[model samples]
Target chain A: MQIKHAASAGTLESSDITITLKPADNGVTIALDSSVEKQFGRQIKAQIEAALKALDITAVAVEATDKGALDCTIKARTIAAAYRAADVQDYDWEEINSWIN
Target chain B: MAELRRIWLTIDHDEAAAWAALLTKSGLAVDHQVEVTFGMFEGETLLATASLYGQIIKCVAVDPAAQSENLLAPLLQAAFDQLDDNGSQHAFIYTKPSTQAFFQSLGFKPLAHSDEVVLLERGYPDLDDYLHTLQQAKRPGSAAAIVMNANPFTRGHHYLVSQAAQQYDTVYVFVLSAERALFSAADRLAMVKLGTQEFSNVVVLPTRDYMVSSATFPSYFLKDRADLAVAKQQARIDAELFVQKIAPTLGITARFVSEEPLSPVTAVYNTELAAAFVGHIQLHVLPRKAVAGAPISATTVRQALQNADQSTLEKLLLPSIYRYIKEHSSHAN
Candidate 1:
């Protein structure tokens, strides 16, 4: 499956990226375009979010284009968008338990 | 060179005339005419001038002509010597940041910053209200004793605080907030806060003039206040009452101070104040903590920095504090 993400400022060229994901035996396979590759190195936020979603047995494709978002904020936004697209209703358990235990 | 004789005194005059002259000359706004006493000192031929208001002293001056000859050292020494002779309990001095080195050369330690003064107390005053306030805020049956100073908030200070925390359920660290310190009060408070962030139960507050001023006996700022012993004593009596009677309204009880043999005058005054307490507060003197070649003193830390001995300073301060000094020094240069 494929997902495309685009982000831009008011005037500057909108930095964009496309990602392709496939469910594997153990984890998920992620492929990134050159634009995203230059901005965030390979297997960065995109792969991390895909792996998190795959943990719930949801095989999904996700892509994001970030315009100067900090690493933490990017990770949060990507994870949120991924969960919403997958229609996962109970991902909060993982977040809450991470803080508790 | 001839030896200079130091003469210290607390002068009584109508507040309107004396302080008004001072304010007008110094270009400060004159507001109220409170009955205030000025603490002054004369060495050989009045080399330097200073004034004390409650627990704060301001306008410490050394004649520019005599600056090359370093007149403040002898003047300060004379002030302390006179206080000792008169049996006065303590003395305190406040100096501007630019002139701190001059006073420090004469063994005047840098205290925490207040609004516009840095305070140096010759002796520690009693913490009766501080103790009572602690008792009132602490959990039932939980008692607290805190000895607060600005040791520039180093590792050694952290060690002392952790030790104090072990003995009490809650510890109140009173930072001297006088304005005369070299580092701004905000910086001192930040250093202290960063240094002690690991301790959960320690509460930090400012020690206002009422608790740490030379106006209280034994006078800790000027020695000549001893010559006017009766008036100095009355001022201290009034200041102590102000602390004991008024400070409780602010919730402070029991004060903790590090034990220092070099300054026995402070020890004696602390004893007297504790004895005078009417069962509402207490004073605790923690034993001095020494770490091999260095004693955990702000004076020693300053000396280490002045000597540019980073190794010795590192042993005395936390890594963050050492970094802070290095960063500030680079920026200054």
Candidate 2:
């Protein structure tokens, strides 16, 4: 299955990425457009992996268009988009703890 | 000289009316505004009058025609004595600028000059603005947080901020901005600024009414409420908003708080908020720095003022605040 997702920050030209998923695979494959790949090539791949792990869905192909995103924000957005694609309304994303253990 | 007579009077409507009547007879016209007291004295004779306006006692006067020695002084002293005996926290008197010197000699300072009246306050100023600004600033290194009420920039408050500063690169102190507070917002801000002058990185900002007022929840939640769950949820929502929306705007991702039991509700809310924002923000609760019994609190300072225990208050407050209070109070008393 092929999924297309677009994320934008108004008037700055929206970035779009496409991901392809295969059956029975427990890892993700990410494809990036040339422009985004040039800017955030390695970081985007890492973010895709983290987002997939966060959603507990390992078998997937992912693509992304990069605006400016920190690793954490990218992870958050990816998990949100993937959840939207799967029609999953609930995910137990771990809460952030402020205290030092 | 008028004879000095000690009369014990309850602060009630009838007593206020009787006091007003006596002041009127003694050539002192009292409009009888709430929270005002008036009196008249001649030679050693002391004529006392008081008007009760709601929970506050106003329009205390002494008979001018009555022969009394130091009539005004004794009359004012007597009224304060009565209120002190009754354990009143709020008291005020309106006198002309010329007579201000006399009141100052007695221990009252001009509260703040206004177009209509020169107000005199008996307590410390509130430092909410500075604390709010601090809370709004971004925390450095995502390591620690800071909070403060800033009731009057005391030495103890300075000590707390300094300690927090040492631990965290950025400390955000939340100044309470509830309208009903005793000190004016500006005065409180000024005092806190003055008190924390040495600490450069500390950011102080005002805590909006929703976060700090009794309408939402008490500062510490000292008493157990029936709807603890509801209160806790509301507090959590407010804290989340503060952390996610407000804190981020100021570049602060962490909150530093003093570990005191006075604000259990806030402590609980912070714990939950921290969990929700885990990995994004940090919450640090510092143990109290105490000299005598337990940690220092504004309540303890106020109690000392009420009891005339200047020593304890001096110990708890900064030198500037102590000097301001002493100089102003000495003039008024």
Candidate 3:
């Protein structure tokens, strides 16, 4: 699915990631910043990409400011931003929650 | 006054022990479970220290000579900036009663009180500002008030609002701002605005760290029966602030709440609300709206969505809330 417009989710608080996204025509482009970027940058990006892929979302610009959010938090925020961008109402709750499972 | 620069405390820092001793000497209990502990130092000497543990900022103390100087505010400002840098927009400071006014002068409003510590916040809108904004849109006379999360605005919530709009001259719907909620705060605000559009007299406001807010009642998130006693006391302090400050500021004469059969936490909160406002404001306890012989609540609406129970969700939520949640709920996997 194509991102329809600009949207955001999450916060700057500890253990949270604030995700901002805008529509794109080709593929997902991610720009990320985090204190532990040197060590976890690739890991965080992988987590985000996995979430967007699970949502079947493509063609988007993603900006994520991570404050040590765990893998599950990154996924949730990424998918949440996707929902806001697509302007869809129903979400895959179990899939989003299954991070723990 | 001596110049004080911030010093982040660490085990290697030379003054770490001094900071610990100061809190004890100052009659303030030391919370070892701090997220960040720092102090204001004058050159090599530590004059004051404050600790942050989640929303609670504590372990604050000043050297005897520095007490007469104006230093607490700057020390607090340092802590506040740290909290903000970490993405906390609103925060609580645990301080001694004698120094309460010092915090108040710096835009920190007191929310709850105990014999030992007082809780104050820096980001909640001032009561006067809230009133001023409401004045431009509505009149002040015999208003009914309610504070709700409406995580997903249920039909039961709508029923309560409809009754309040008809029974009173004005209705103030205060949505509990989320430090964390399933629905985004922006979406929740928009849903309520559109949901209650028919009632021109209905004024929606953010429950700005006022009563039963997450900041005022952090223990509430625990949802454990073991924490019940402490939660009750916290709610009492919060409700007192509501009846004593917030209700009077808005000229609200009656407060509305539904009896909770589903959550023990809310049932205790309602009981506290009733007790706090007995002589000040009338408390109306409305019965929970039920569907399939069960109460219609945000909790049930969330469960239905998680379970993919479309019929239960449709029955529990207003069309707007259902639509909002359908589009906005954060998935769990």
Candidate 4:
């Protein structure tokens, strides 16, 4: 879905992530910041990209600040942020869970 | 390890003394006037704290013992959430150079820095976007700049802009965008644009949050009334941002100003700007334009405004500016 507005979800606390989304002109750009960037930066980015792909969100700028969150947490934060940026108030939990699992 | 309870000083002022002590211990001066102050406490001990003043987050201090707790991340999260609630799409932090990396981890990109302080920001339409917009307006020539609040555009402002227009191949007038003055930023900018229409070489632009903003020069706003030392440091930060980033980007070689015989705050800023611009950019201080024996100033214009003295206002302002003020003030009344 096309991102309608800028939104963010999650926090900077431990084992969590903060995802900020801004509407962009073209393509997805994810700027990830994590202490584990050297080790799992690619994996973390891959998880975010996969979630955005699941949501079919194109033309969005993503800033993810990771505090060593697990893949599930990362995906959850990304989906939450994308939905908010898209201004989709109601959640289709069945469909979202299908993408996560 | 018990879960930390949060303290909101705006809600509860009882912990203010503890908050000040913690900040002092962490090497931050306590500025009591911030809009929001948040503290994280484990039992009775204040572990970390952060405060927001407009769009700027400042006076953040985490106790060394709580360093293991990783309190900064959560503290800043609280700050950002508060900012979001305030409907501020952007935020800045004026911090020490040493702590830059930690804030960077939270997604703040450093925009400019001097030896003493670094200005970092987090949000869209950031400094690069601002600079890119400015780059479009850049002209190749001996360019000079003048930055002014122009609370009400006066003959004094016209004199400074006209003088620069004559001396330089191109002149850029950056009107202060801070809304703390008697006139709104939009009004101030309009007045400057209207007042300088005769100067063909002049380009009028808003300073945005990059220059003399509450972020850069908080003292310009009355509520942020700072002491001489604080004002000097803020002036240095503002000047360095210009000399290091803005001047080079826009090819501004020199800046023009009239001598300040009024307003001690502005006088201090002028002194600091002179010192900071040395060896980097040229600083020209022209004599104040006077009427009879007295200098023409926006402060004088404001005084005339307060008394509804049209004659004094007409004598001090250009026809365009006078007309704009007359129309707007009537609308306001």
Give the TM-score of chain A, superposed on the true chain A, for all candidates in the order listed: 0.44, 0.58, 0.89, 0.96
- Over A1-101, each residue of candidate 2 has an lDDT whose tens digit, in order, gives 22232211111122433232222234567654324556677877876676566456666645444444556556655656666556556655443122111
What would the per-residue lDDT of candidate 3 be over residues B1-333, giving only the tens digit for each residue?
355454446554557677777877887655465667767777767788777767667677888867856566566656767766886645677566888976664446666675545777654234444555655655667898988887778888898999889899999998877557777777888888878998889998887556566556655656654267657767777777777767777788899999887677777888888887888899999998888888887877777777899888788877766776666656622
Give the alpha carbon lDDT tens digit for every residue of B1-333 in model 4. 524455666566668778988889988888876887777887876878888889899889888777867778777877878888877768899899999999998889888787888889987657776787799899888999999999998999999998999999999999998888889999999999899998888988889998989888888675335677788888888888898889999999899988987677788889988998999889999999999889998888999989888889889999888889888885444
lDDT of 1 at B34: 21
Root-mean-square deviation of Cα positions for candidate 3 versus the true structure, in angstroms: 16.4
Query: TM-scores, in order shown?
Result: 0.41, 0.41, 0.61, 0.91
Candidate of highest lDDT = 4
**How does model 3 score by TM-score?**
0.61
Error (Å) of candidate 3 at residue B212 is 3.2
Model 2 segments more than 4 A misplaced: A1-101, B1-145, B154-156, B213-227, B262-267, B326-332
What DockQ does every candidate get? 0.01, 0.00, 0.02, 0.65
Worst 10 residues of 2 chain B by lDDT: B121-130
Of candidate 1 chain A, the 10-residue stretch with the lowest lDDT total is: A4-13
Candidate 1 on B1-333: residue-level lDDT in tens?
424532223243443254455455544444231222222324223444344334334445554544565444444444544544665434555445566655543334443332343445433232433445544544432445443446477665677678777776667675656555556667677778777778887777665544443333324433333334323333334335434553354344555556665544444445545554447665566676777854577767878777887778888888888777677663443
Where is model 1 chain B poorest over a 10-residue stretch in terms of lDDT? B31-40
Give all candidates' CA lDDT scores.
0.48, 0.52, 0.74, 0.86
- Shift of residue A2 alpha carbon in model 3, Å: 43
Instruction: State residue A100's C-alpha deviation in candidate 3, in Å.
Output: 63
